[model samples]
Target: MRDPVATAMQVCPVEIATAVLGGSWKLTIVKHLLEEPLRRGQLKRRIPLAPDRTLTRQLRELEDDGIVHREVFDHVPPMVEYSLTELGHSLAPVVTVVDSWGATYRWTIDATK
Candidate 1:
Protein backbone atom coordinates (compact mmCIF):
# COMPACT_ATOMS: atom_id res chain seq x y z
CA MET A 1 0.00 0.00 0.00
CA ARG A 2 1.17 3.51 -0.71
CA ASP A 3 1.71 5.90 2.19
CA PRO A 4 0.01 9.22 1.63
CA VAL A 5 2.17 11.01 4.13
CA ALA A 6 5.31 9.73 2.43
CA THR A 7 4.05 10.96 -0.89
CA ALA A 8 3.18 14.36 0.53
CA MET A 9 6.60 14.65 2.11
CA GLN A 10 8.23 14.33 -1.28
CA VAL A 11 6.74 17.64 -2.33
CA CYS A 12 7.24 19.43 0.98
CA PRO A 13 10.55 19.40 2.77
CA VAL A 14 8.98 20.69 5.97
CA GLU A 15 6.44 17.91 5.90
CA ILE A 16 9.18 15.36 5.36
CA ALA A 17 11.08 16.68 8.37
CA THR A 18 7.98 16.82 10.52
CA ALA A 19 7.06 13.30 9.52
CA VAL A 20 10.53 12.12 10.55
CA LEU A 21 10.69 14.07 13.82
CA GLY A 22 7.15 14.82 14.92
CA GLY A 23 6.69 12.10 17.54
CA SER A 24 6.43 13.07 21.21
CA TRP A 25 9.49 11.16 22.38
CA LYS A 26 11.75 11.01 19.34
CA LEU A 27 13.57 14.25 20.05
CA THR A 28 13.92 13.41 23.72
CA ILE A 29 15.37 10.04 22.82
CA VAL A 30 17.76 11.70 20.42
CA LYS A 31 18.80 14.18 23.07
CA HIS A 32 19.77 11.43 25.49
CA LEU A 33 21.58 9.45 22.82
CA LEU A 34 23.69 12.52 22.07
CA GLU A 35 25.53 12.04 25.36
CA GLU A 36 26.65 8.48 24.65
CA PRO A 37 25.44 5.08 23.61
CA LEU A 38 22.93 3.74 26.13
CA ARG A 39 21.39 0.39 26.77
CA ARG A 40 17.62 -0.03 26.42
CA GLY A 41 17.19 -0.20 30.17
CA GLN A 42 19.20 2.93 30.73
CA LEU A 43 17.29 4.81 28.07
CA LYS A 44 13.99 3.70 29.57
CA ARG A 45 15.11 4.83 33.02
CA ARG A 46 15.97 8.23 31.63
CA ILE A 47 12.51 8.52 30.10
CA PRO A 48 10.39 7.13 32.87
CA LEU A 49 7.28 8.97 31.82
CA ALA A 50 7.04 7.21 28.48
CA PRO A 51 5.42 3.80 28.50
CA ASP A 52 7.55 0.78 27.64
CA ARG A 53 5.63 0.06 24.44
CA THR A 54 5.78 3.66 23.33
CA LEU A 55 9.52 3.84 23.89
CA THR A 56 9.99 0.61 22.03
CA ARG A 57 7.93 1.84 19.12
CA GLN A 58 9.81 5.13 19.00
CA LEU A 59 13.15 3.36 19.06
CA ARG A 60 12.08 1.10 16.24
CA GLU A 61 10.91 4.05 14.21
CA LEU A 62 14.20 5.83 14.76
CA GLU A 63 16.08 2.73 13.73
CA ASP A 64 14.01 2.47 10.57
CA ASP A 65 14.66 6.12 9.80
CA GLY A 66 18.43 5.67 9.98
CA ILE A 67 18.62 8.10 12.87
CA VAL A 68 19.62 5.44 15.38
CA HIS A 69 21.82 2.38 15.22
CA ARG A 70 21.12 -0.64 17.37
CA GLU A 71 24.01 -2.83 18.41
CA VAL A 72 23.53 -6.29 19.78
CA PHE A 73 26.30 -7.84 21.85
CA ASP A 74 26.60 -11.50 22.61
CA HIS A 75 26.88 -12.09 26.33
CA VAL A 76 25.48 -14.28 29.07
CA PRO A 77 22.27 -12.29 28.94
CA PRO A 78 22.01 -10.55 25.54
CA MET A 79 22.72 -6.83 25.51
CA VAL A 80 21.47 -4.17 23.13
CA GLU A 81 22.73 -0.62 22.90
CA TYR A 82 21.50 2.33 20.87
CA SER A 83 23.52 5.20 19.48
CA LEU A 84 23.03 7.89 16.88
CA THR A 85 24.16 7.28 13.30
CA GLU A 86 26.13 9.90 11.38
CA LEU A 87 22.87 11.16 9.97
CA GLY A 88 21.53 11.33 13.48
CA HIS A 89 24.66 13.14 14.69
CA SER A 90 23.85 15.87 12.20
CA LEU A 91 20.84 16.77 14.33
CA ALA A 92 22.85 17.44 17.47
CA PRO A 93 23.23 21.15 16.78
CA VAL A 94 19.60 21.39 15.82
CA VAL A 95 18.56 19.67 19.00
CA THR A 96 20.82 21.93 21.06
CA VAL A 97 19.24 25.03 19.54
CA VAL A 98 15.77 23.66 20.12
CA ASP A 99 16.63 22.79 23.72
CA SER A 100 17.91 26.30 24.31
CA TRP A 101 14.70 27.72 22.92
CA GLY A 102 12.64 25.44 25.12
CA ALA A 103 14.56 26.54 28.21
CA THR A 104 14.05 30.18 27.38
CA TYR A 105 10.38 29.62 26.71
CA ARG A 106 9.94 27.80 30.00
CA TRP A 107 11.78 30.53 31.90
CA THR A 108 9.61 33.22 30.36
CA ILE A 109 6.46 31.30 31.15
CA ASP A 110 7.57 30.72 34.72
CA ALA A 111 8.37 34.39 35.22
CA THR A 112 4.87 35.32 34.14
CA LYS A 113 3.22 32.73 36.32
Candidate 2:
Protein backbone atom coordinates (compact mmCIF):
# COMPACT_ATOMS: atom_id res chain seq x y z
CA MET A 1 0.00 0.00 0.00
CA ARG A 2 1.05 3.64 -0.53
CA ASP A 3 2.32 5.72 2.37
CA PRO A 4 -0.26 7.79 4.24
CA VAL A 5 1.74 10.98 3.81
CA ALA A 6 2.00 10.44 0.09
CA THR A 7 -1.71 9.77 -0.18
CA ALA A 8 -2.56 12.94 1.76
CA MET A 9 -0.22 15.02 -0.35
CA GLN A 10 -1.76 13.66 -3.51
CA VAL A 11 -5.26 14.27 -2.18
CA CYS A 12 -4.56 17.98 -1.92
CA PRO A 13 -2.44 18.83 -4.91
CA VAL A 14 -0.12 21.82 -5.10
CA GLU A 15 -1.81 22.73 -8.36
CA ILE A 16 -5.02 23.43 -6.44
CA ALA A 17 -3.20 25.82 -4.15
CA THR A 18 -1.41 27.36 -7.07
CA ALA A 19 -4.62 27.75 -8.96
CA VAL A 20 -5.98 29.83 -6.08
CA LEU A 21 -2.89 32.03 -5.93
CA GLY A 22 -0.90 31.55 -9.13
CA GLY A 23 -2.07 34.39 -11.35
CA SER A 24 0.62 36.81 -12.54
CA TRP A 25 -0.08 39.67 -10.16
CA LYS A 26 -2.12 37.98 -7.46
CA LEU A 27 0.86 37.14 -5.26
CA THR A 28 2.37 40.57 -5.81
CA ILE A 29 -0.86 42.24 -4.78
CA VAL A 30 -1.16 40.04 -1.70
CA LYS A 31 2.45 40.67 -0.71
CA HIS A 32 2.00 44.42 -1.08
CA LEU A 33 -1.11 44.44 1.09
CA LEU A 34 0.27 42.13 3.79
CA GLU A 35 1.52 45.02 5.88
CA GLU A 36 -1.22 47.63 5.69
CA PRO A 37 -4.19 48.99 3.83
CA LEU A 38 -3.60 50.60 0.42
CA ARG A 39 -5.47 52.65 -2.12
CA ARG A 40 -5.83 51.82 -5.80
CA GLY A 41 -3.21 54.27 -6.94
CA GLN A 42 -0.80 53.05 -4.29
CA LEU A 43 -1.24 49.49 -5.53
CA LYS A 44 -0.81 50.59 -9.12
CA ARG A 45 2.41 52.29 -8.17
CA ARG A 46 3.58 49.19 -6.38
CA ILE A 47 3.03 46.86 -9.36
CA PRO A 48 3.28 49.11 -12.40
CA LEU A 49 3.39 46.29 -14.92
CA ALA A 50 -0.04 45.02 -13.84
CA PRO A 51 -2.92 46.28 -15.91
CA ASP A 52 -5.56 48.18 -13.97
CA ARG A 53 -8.40 46.06 -15.27
CA THR A 54 -6.69 42.79 -14.30
CA LEU A 55 -5.89 44.06 -10.85
CA THR A 56 -9.47 45.13 -10.36
CA ARG A 57 -10.69 41.72 -11.44
CA GLN A 58 -8.38 39.85 -9.07
CA LEU A 59 -9.32 42.15 -6.20
CA ARG A 60 -12.96 41.50 -6.93
CA GLU A 61 -12.33 37.74 -6.84
CA LEU A 62 -10.51 38.04 -3.54
CA GLU A 63 -13.31 40.10 -2.10
CA ASP A 64 -15.88 37.55 -3.25
CA ASP A 65 -13.85 34.80 -1.62
CA GLY A 66 -14.07 36.76 1.67
CA ILE A 67 -10.33 37.27 1.74
CA VAL A 68 -10.30 41.01 1.07
CA HIS A 69 -12.30 43.91 2.43
CA ARG A 70 -12.94 47.12 0.49
CA GLU A 71 -13.59 50.35 2.30
CA VAL A 72 -14.83 53.46 0.59
CA PHE A 73 -14.54 56.91 2.11
CA ASP A 74 -16.97 59.63 1.23
CA HIS A 75 -14.68 62.42 0.16
CA VAL A 76 -13.97 64.85 -2.66
CA PRO A 77 -11.91 62.28 -4.51
CA PRO A 78 -13.97 59.33 -3.29
CA MET A 79 -11.26 57.41 -1.57
CA VAL A 80 -11.16 53.62 -1.63
CA GLU A 81 -8.81 51.41 0.33
CA TYR A 82 -8.34 47.64 0.58
CA SER A 83 -7.11 45.55 3.44
CA LEU A 84 -7.22 41.92 4.49
CA THR A 85 -10.37 40.47 5.90
CA GLU A 86 -10.27 37.90 8.69
CA LEU A 87 -10.15 35.23 6.06
CA GLY A 88 -7.30 36.97 4.34
CA HIS A 89 -5.41 37.20 7.60
CA SER A 90 -5.61 33.43 7.77
CA LEU A 91 -3.84 33.32 4.44
CA ALA A 92 -0.86 35.35 5.59
CA PRO A 93 1.17 32.43 6.82
CA VAL A 94 0.53 30.50 3.63
CA VAL A 95 1.56 33.51 1.59
CA THR A 96 4.70 33.90 3.68
CA VAL A 97 5.74 30.31 2.98
CA VAL A 98 5.24 30.87 -0.74
CA ASP A 99 7.18 34.12 -0.54
CA SER A 100 10.08 32.44 1.22
CA TRP A 101 10.09 29.61 -1.34
CA GLY A 102 10.27 32.16 -4.16
CA ALA A 103 13.11 33.96 -2.45
CA THR A 104 15.10 30.76 -2.18
CA TYR A 105 14.24 29.31 -5.60
CA ARG A 106 14.48 32.51 -7.63
CA TRP A 107 18.21 32.78 -7.05
CA THR A 108 18.79 29.63 -9.13
CA ILE A 109 18.14 31.65 -12.29
CA ASP A 110 21.44 33.18 -13.38
CA ALA A 111 20.42 36.45 -14.96
CA THR A 112 23.85 37.22 -16.39
CA LYS A 113 25.05 33.71 -17.04
lDDT of 2 by residue, 16-37 (tens): 4554565678777788889889
Against the true structure, candidate 2 has what lDDT? 0.77
| Model 2 ranges off by over 4 Å | 1-19
Error of 2 at 11 (Å): 9.2
Error of 1 at 34 (Å): 0.8
Candidate 1's C-alpha runs over 4 A off are 1-5
Ten contiguous residues minimizing lDDT sum, candidate 1: 1-10
lDDT of 1 by residue, 67-109 (tens): 9999999986999999999999998998999899999999999
Per-prediction TM-score: 0.92, 0.78
- lDDT of predicted model 1: 0.88
